[model samples]
Target: MAILKQDLSFLKNNVKQVDAEMFTSKIRGIMDSHAPQTSRTVTDRTSSPWFSVESKAVKQARRGTERKWNKSGLEIDKQIYLYHKKQVRGINLTAKREYYNLKFSEVQNSKDFFNLSNELLGKDKNTKLPKSIKSELLPDTFGDFFIEKIEKLRHTLVSDFNHDEDFDDSQSDASTLSTLSPVTNDDVKTTILSAVSKHCDLNPMPIYLLKNC
Candidate 1:
């Protein structure tokens, strides 16, 4: 799946839209075929067939999940950092950088950045952010919140860039910062699934073609 996504990124970067579509279709097929199967039996966790089916692919798949989580977490942290960086004091900036640096180091050493990412992206456990910074980065839940924020930022940036390029003659060079809307919980889930589908569908064509070539 990670390889499929990487292939998709390559196609996207190379501007091969048609090939990208084919790769995505292939990825969907592969995912559908090899999708993990869960058992309802009480002994399934301990005696599952998957546990014994040792293969290089399985090991890589496990690694891929960790990679995805880390990547998603890092993206969310970047969005949260950017949204509030302006309002953050010099001391806050130093603290924030140190906090993220610590989290990154932890992830490197422990291969677990999920929980820490949640801490940074989630609410303060006391109150919402001050009025100086919009709460666009605040996530309502932990289920894939990191991926959600990244998507929101992606869409917002795309919209802002398009708005600036298309109608710059009429509108002032004002920041679209105020017009930006916060990402809702539902929006996060929806966008995350949408992105997964889109990327999974889009990422495998180049590799498939490269194999043929």
Candidate 2:
């Protein structure tokens, strides 16, 4: 922080004659000197909302254990450090759960519930999409996926619809009537089944896709 202050002070005292590019480069260099370049980065304990005085103490203890384990490479120290890591996870999880539970328990209406729920589930957590079949998605992603499926179904129903083969050849108007008729869910299902029958392997369909017509 002090380094940042000093760097900013230099920027503040910059001359009008200084080249804009050189001034920016100097600021970047100052920042680089103060910032971590290693693969492992440690965030300040005070940055987390759940982090309290006790949390800081626990974190320091864990770090001390980690340092000792790194130096000695003892099995006992390794176990102790692992235990501290587990304890820290539990502390953070419990603190977050209790905090949100308390905050949400007071929600008395649908609007309040959704507001609190959205707040608790941060933007990054709430906007995630499914990468594959087994992967979990954000709540909105599931709804959007289904909505798209329904739209596709609607398009398929209107566009790919064919005249019924079962129509009587005796009736001259049967083919015309079948083509002109409005599409129904049963008709959509029949057309889908017929198309799948050509494949014959009967690949299992996704359960989500089967939720509606």
Best by lDDT: 2
lDDT of 1 by residue, 53-157 (tens): 333334445455556656787776555544443433443445557657866786853425665666667835455455654466344444367789899999999
**Every model's TM-score:** 0.16, 0.36
TM-score of 2: 0.36
Q: Which residue pairs clash in candidate 2?
A: none
Q: What lDDT score is found at residue 158 in candidate 2?
A: 67
Candidate 1 global TM-score: 0.16
Task: Indicate the worst ten consecutive residues by lDDT in candidate 1.
Answer: 47-56
**Model 2, CA-based lDDT:** 0.68
RMSD (Cα, Å) of model 1? 24.8
lDDT of each: 0.54, 0.68
Identify the candidate with maximal TM-score: 2
Model 1, clash count?
5
